[model samples]
Target chain A: MGFIDARELPDGHTVETDVCIVGAGAAGLALASALSSGTGGARVLLVESGGFEHDDHTQYLHQGQVVGREYPLGISRLRYFGGTTNHWGGNVRPLDAIDMEPRPWVPHSGWPITRAELDPYYERALAFLGLPDDAFELEAWTDGKACRPWELEAELAETEIFPAVAPELRQLGAVRRASIEESANVDVLLHANVLEFETDDPPRAVRAVRVATLQDERFRVQARLFVLATGGIENARLLLLSSSVASAGLGNDHDLVGRYFADHLVIPPVGDLWLSDPELPLDLYLERARANATGRAMGRAIFRLPDGVQREQRLQNCGVQLGPTMPLDVAIRRGKAFRSLDYAWRAVQEGDLPDDFHYHVANVIADVDELVAGGYRLASYRAAYPTWHVDLIAVAEPAPNPESRVRLGDERDPLGQRRIVLDWRLSPSDQDSVRRSTDLLAAAFALAGIGRVRVQMPEGGLDWFRPSPHMHHLGTTRMADDPKSGVVDRNCRVHGIENLWIAGSSVFPTYGHVNPTFTILALAFRLGDHLRGVLA
Target chain B: MTTPFAVRRRDVLRLLAALGGAGFGAGAGVGAGAQAEAASRETLVAARVRLRLVSPESASLLGAAYLRDRPDEDSPAHLAVALGLDAGATDIAAIAARHRDDLRSGRVHRLDGFGFSRTELRLCALLYLTDRA
Candidate 1:
């Protein structure tokens, strides 16, 4: 393996390789690792836009404005060798069988590939992520003790397991960096930003990829195959930016390069659960209780609607997790510091300070006593092992909406490339699904005499609903058998383009409430196999 | 042998007492001082006509609270009909059964953000009236 800095390359230099991967994120690395181990003679080029750590220049390139909804785009993702995996929360779970199937109620739902197609690669992905293949088995973790008091009648809800990777192995980039650097057939290039895809006259195939560095050094990488493993938004932006030959863009014949963007909607502490039996053993679902013998929090158990119930009710998948409720005093103390910090960061992003900024700072200063007390309590054992009540967090799946898209804005970055304009939109049915699923969960708990759930959602429609993102960008370059419906084919190859494929959550046709890292790696491994055969 | 009605009345009373003593009232402590005040005999007798098998004092307090909150369902006749109890029935066992069924079937009314089955609501209403009425 060779580690090269883009600046070290001479200007107008050309490098040739068998396979060129555009992003050295989880997908790129996984694909590279798979290719290096399986494909005997293929030379792999792994290119990254940033160095090993976060840089201000690359972060600025990620800055974009929102059109339809207010979303923090720049701060949500990282730009480095590891990509967003550098700060990923480490929770992992494969998508359910229903998530891959098309629902009659959901317009642009369903994947060209099924769960069975990815099953073999999923095990490899888990092993690559440093977990046992059986990590998602909820019964193994709880031994059935964590189930509801009575069997939920008619299978209204089901429990799903989400295991957190080991703390030391959480940063996949750092964990696999040494091995990737030592692979004999791979070349890792840092600060090698891809400018555009230089294609033939018809734009039926990608000829070469133009790469650049912040220092004005430009080069070209011609490969037999190309993969844009960039994050979801960047993948679409790159495709839409490559307009040198096709005029519209490479593989943008149907104008579907950046449509149907989706991300998970997370609502923290939606309600409180009051258990009828105070001594009920729900430890499997709590953070501290789930900690293994090594004192690392192992995983979490979540509640979601069963497949049959989802189809019958015409609902999207919504996951609800139960954790210990934060004491009100602790919330107030933590909230002051959080509010002040959040406002300051947003002000910096906007390049202007708000009038009430001083008030937030003053409030934080005034609550110093609370801040210290809250910190001490959080570090103490009592805070970790709370048993009084349970707080419910709802993470709802996003239905693909063509109107929710990422497009090029008039504004350009320092490199003269048009910045992204993300217009994220959610349908009314999305909100309705969340409400209905939450009610069903409450009903199950109530009927079992386990407890009661007081849903704290405001009384009204989408106007009163404000959902935060889980930072899992998905469905931007969705996979479908038909070119008109999606950008990528079942094999993740961009439709209507030869030798061009996508590898990441961006190719996900539907994103279940689960995290996308596991499936992203699975797809990467699957693509690696496909590419090996093609290059063979 | 003790009848099922005796066990049910005792249980409801115990639950009501526990809620009041622990201050876990679903807003049941609006007028705490009223419990110190006594209801007139005529008022007690009038309230007692609505239900049987429950103590006169318990019946009076609960009936007044029930009538005050759900003024539309003025008497036990309406409450029995709403709870799926036999019309005009004053059986405590039947009342308890209806309460359990409501909870089991997800039929609950909310008061002060706390969910309560209709039977539990009636009892909570009684607790609130005892402290205030």
Candidate 2:
């Protein structure tokens, strides 16, 4: 078997391989599987800090202080083999072409590699993700019934399709674990925590990696090349921790190691869409079974502004999804009644009334009939269709700000490694993008005579509506053509260092308004093909 | 002499009065408070006439029936008093006019003291527009 318990190995043992991958998460495992299956003659060593299941001791290592917003650090990520994909929702989308182009208004906002360069790899990544190899065409999936004639001009807004494969069948560990076990030239080592890189003089090239096990076992893995497939945060953390050679960091010669952190900002429901044509079949815009496909579900059709509109308005990429809404009174009463009963039951269990017990009871008494009617509507419509209106929930792309970064804190973990301090910052341009995009959409709907849209601003206005993080960590170690602007080059190799590279969303220069897993996998495949060519 | 709008208005007024009386009678004994019941019936009639020009069918489809069947505990008199109107007065037309003005000014007028929600306030605005027409 390719699996090896690193703790069982003899102390001071040295293993030799052609390539040593530091992490066994989604990117790491995908790259390892690709290399092992290739015709190349290179042997691979894949290291994982945690075992097959969740381990609290290893999970606790991810805990750290959050500065700007209240972020749940400990629960946001997993330390196991599959990484965060253990709980991912499996939403995949490719970055738009505009997302890869440099916008003059947005500082440090462009990719060294364009979307066209990644298109072939994205097609290959679909097989890895278990999605259909065909293009994400809405007509093919919906049997031509999905597209409805838009009354508005197509330049204003367009329908975007999102396809979701079964997450369980496509999880990295679940899909490739068997193949990895039977591979002849690949070694899977669990509980092997990569501590630092031991480099030759001048530290321009990586020679060996030092790994430590929880049981105090130490070993060295010498390889021809080393790839840091660790996640966005840890990739920078490992580089920063390996300061014995470069002082600032291995790739920090230009002082740009851990910078340009970004995450998608999901704005709260900003408007309500009351469709004039009540007979319009909205099932296509909702989660439903594909017409001919079995065991696969088609995601809701999202509305995105066309590229021309985005450029004209100078707004960031944002997409809107329709969410069911109801009269505020009905929703409040039903919610209050349900919460009251839940609190009463909890009070019976705890033997004490909650502080807001009377408030809940009074709300239930005030609108009992409306509450009953709301319940009937909810039961009949399944809470997916609103009785009167629907809300416009916008998922927006945040601008790349060099100030929003992840740095090492003074606190140390059980392994004596410094923890991360996340300062997640959003710019004023980010908020402006959301506001302007909603305005343009509302204007388009009005011009088309489809319906009226009422922008629902908070009592304190747009500033009061704080954008919540989408947990998509990206852009920390960005890719740029020059070493002065980024940590990695176009090939994902460390700018000045040889035999060292990066994988995953850490190399994303700009994050589009979609999930990053598919893109991460595609980039890993590209890197794998490149490494195969180099090693051969 | 009644047009279709006026006829529909009358029918809606009768329905609203009936619903209000039935609800009030259920909550409070019908025979014990005949004077208060008569006053609620008059208020419902006045409200129906004031809302005659609005699309009563659309208003009913939007769950106006809930307003009648489950009227808030506070009476129209209490709402008028809270709005700084004279006591014993329930001029829904005047209330609707003020609400329309607040909406035109892009301000959300507080209706919590009058025991009404935004949906209920919208219905009141429809009544006001009908009365003006």
Candidate 3:
């Protein structure tokens, strides 16, 4: 029964533990819960910067500058007990085998660990995520009764199923707080911001983590082992902040800490799908199917190229999701209004006067009639079968780029820690892959007699489209077999550090097009098992 | 093998690619077999009258690319039979209506990655035959 508030702790207090897990996100929580469960479980200390709920001061620590492209550095993630899972949409799927393999076309690709090595832990991870089973096929959810998936040409495109935990059970911090708090072997520390890692003369091992609170309460947590489960960006930031022993940073002998950053690129409304049959059985693909016999969560179908085709085309993995059909004019009006409003909002958020704000407002006002009509049509579109038109949204994999990185900014946060500067850039091939993949999808849909697709392109044409990062920060502390190529080794241990390990998507070497949460937890559960042996 | 009305195959491939069609097969030039199958003046007039939506030049370009993959469908009448477009037709509106109906009813032909209705493919084939003549 230990849930310590660092703000209330006396100054200069020291707490000793067997294992100190930092940042109580999905990975941290999973590790804490796993390490503290059952007899012979290790005594664990879990530390989180934020408490059970959020406060402004704690959230402000996440503020960072975006130099390469406009990214939501501050808002993309939350700094609460559950971490970003607090607002996660709950889409979960394991990476395809091809995602882990090194492709000749993609630079800095390949994972130190294979999918086969992580397969056993995926089921456990699913259970941890409150999913009953790990059946990912479309028929598994439908039993071939409720609906049938689109029979696209196998050579061109294949159906991929993604299961999602229900919204009610998504937030791990809210759901597992009681169990985690009740664990006798674990002590949870709230509002404890880890400032630096104090290591030996050569920084070969982490002796203790120097922590502070917003209230200026300073404390220390010494442990036999330390795990940084903060996040992709924060993990790298903290490592860079710990400059006491290693001049560059802890485990910075190779200077590979905050490189190879990647995130799935989302291009919304890339095209419109005109179905040949209005009554096509699209329940499994469109509206998500409910829990099946195995009690798996709701599942929906996504489309992507088969692995062989992707390799043959020398393309990165790109997945497409279909949105509900609406009237063409309504879609146009809605898109225009939303795009203008989005631009204005982003400009305002960046502290710049919204350029053409009045013009966009005027355009929106002029589009009011069509927008209202579209909203009404969308509500009644179910009855009007002949007018079905769905928009295609592409979620593409980002190739590992060394230039795309997260670095320590000059500005210091309230906790006196350097804020991060994220230069998240996409390689030219990244956009090319999406364009080629979308074209192939369009052709495949037409040739299969499925439908025609009217692809959306800017003035730059079909070959180009503006892409937004899908808020999935990955590969900042990438894992590899060698120290020069990655910050962490195959076991997620910082290469030069003996007692320090990294967890979560930050260690993902090559992030796949699907959501990263499933793989993140799988790695965490695997790490938990590994640390259990070490602690024993 | 150049004819007065011969359209460059590269132009056709580029157009097909732009139309979201897969231009898979032989490289950039018309095959001698396709160049040899010439259409009569009557066929050209009928094709122009029937497929007014597609110009003779554009239809010839699209049809040449389509036939390059399926050499067996080189003959305009044979291609028409294969596409189920050999039925009696009254006017351009009837052919257009049938094309739309065919697309809706799954009576379609696929070539160079573009999904084509039977009526549309047959009209294009006839236009190609006319261009060769």
Candidate 4:
């Protein structure tokens, strides 16, 4: 059995390991997988909040795939060994070099290390994640064939196609679980909800992780190194809740633990590209499209702001995807009876593994128009039939807005910790990023042989509207060399705090328009290497 | 979340963010007390309006702009107040009544989720009828 299939934890009555990692989801498991495999005798203690997929919460809370306000039932994020990765679509993109660059307008921007440094780790991440190879790039590589992301992006999309990961991710997760279980030093614990970090110094040390479960019995696992790889919201929640040393919580010197809360600003299509060039390889292109889109037509190509555009503009980082025309109303309806459809054909419009739950309707309409009219039916199945065609979704870049943050709540959780009141505040600059991105899209949509397009900013404008539930929350605990700038320093370590590292997108200084699991898992791979020394 | 006197920039941003997050449903901005005292009351039809974020060039859009129905009458909190929110009472229905103008004009913008309300708007049409009351 693979790493994820084994429901049983490491056989033990409280045994010791060289290192202890909290959170078993994507980041946590990825790190453990890398560490156990790479390091010798690295005693590892992996703590999971929930159990296997069959576990009560996994099936009840996450099986329905509730997120944002969209889910019909109350959606609580799953606490498990694989964490949220189990639910992820696995669209992996390395943190771009420009993403690490300092933008004066973007407050709390800049990663201490460069993208080049993380390149090798990203490769390790890709391999572990079962993602496609990074095309011909020397820095990043994976076993999967040409990833084949559409080519609006000069460097990335042409080479990278994120391997369709819904089923495979879980399957590989099994392998990862067994490899770790068989290891002599590694001890895996199920239902281990790490409640608090009892620290000695203000920002210098972590003595132990106070872990507990619903059963009420709790124990403190004292490890020289304690890593919190929970997730974007949970990581910050834990920090804010652990009000032991500082009321503001651990590593929240500037109250930055849960600030700069961000998500993908999911833009609907203004129009689809009626390609003037018939020479384009359309069928071959569609096959490689990540198993996300459900319908037929050309694949998604990443949008890079023209060099001149990037240089002159206040652009942080942005990308866009070209998808077949699909209406929200129709998709929601089709999704209601999603079970019976020929999902193989539908996967083209959506992604590989068909999920009606979280994914935006990528395949409701296949852009299959009778005539070569620039505009087809507006929304075919749904009633807005006046205008029809595939649409362009311009994903704006994410900037750190101190105003956009998660705050602590007075209410306690089942674990008796303060509930994190997520107060995601976007700065004026973030709104500008959207507008600038819209303008760039307009310019590109006009230039690229695509069809008519419109850029729709939120009604209350960018600041006043909700960023879509695209599941791309990032930049709460940013990493940097300077203490004042970010939460963790280079190598994903919390500045000044020893033996406490963070894995996952929480440490990202900026966010790109891609799912973070692949790259984040990559970072975990790199971090696990650094941690192997501590394990010994 | 709100202020006693004029809205502070921080409170204003927080209020706007909340409204933006909540899709400018009117009642979503009720948590802040200061917004409650300085209520910009309007009718429901008058409150639900279109809006966009304010940037360098677009900030001009913030000031008074008339809606589809009220072409002449301008929005009260004209300069976009974060997405579409007014810090008022927690009860959304009451809050919607108090700040009808905020909704009618683009002073606040609604967050996403099939925002163009047909039914609530029909009720708002009923509200426009009883204007004198």
Each model's lDDT comes to 0.75, 0.69, 0.75, 0.52
lDDT of 1 by residue, B1-133 (tens): 1112222334445554433311122222213333333255332322222112234254345446456557876544344355443332345555656655665455665533434566655654443333342
Name model 2 segments beyond 4 Å from true: A143-152, A291-297, A325-374, A377-387, A458-462, B1-133
TM-score of chain B of each: 0.39, 0.25, 0.47, 0.24
The docking category that best describes candidate 3 is: incorrect
Report the poorest 10 consecutive residues by lDDT, candidate 3 chain A.
A456-465
| DockQ of the two-chain complex in candidate 4 | 0.02
RMSD of 4: 16.5
- Model 1: per-residue lDDT, tens digit, A288-378? 2243443344676778878987888788998999855556544753577756866676677668898988887787788767767766766
Q: Can you write out model 4's per-residue Cα lDDT over A351-406, one digit (the tens) per residue?
A: 66645522323332342222212222333442422223344555666667777666
TM-score of chain B of 3: 0.47
Writing each residue's lDDT as its tens digit, candidate 3 over A477-519 gives 9998898898999889999888999999999888889999889
Model 1 off-target regions past 4 Å? A143-154, A288-297, A328-387, B1-71, B87-108, B115-133
Every model: Cα RMSD to truth: 8.9, 12.4, 11.2, 16.5
Pull out the clashing pairs in model 3.
none
- Candidate 4 backbone overlaps, count: 75
For model 3, the stretches where C-alpha displacement exceeds 4 angstroms are A38-41, A143-146, A292-296, A327-387, A458-464, B1-133
Misplaced by over 4 Å in model 4 are A1-15, A54-76, A134-163, A170-172, A201-203, A270-300, A306-308, A326-341, A344-388, A457-460, A463-466, B1-133
Could you tell which candidate, 3 or 4, scores higher by lDDT? Answer: 3
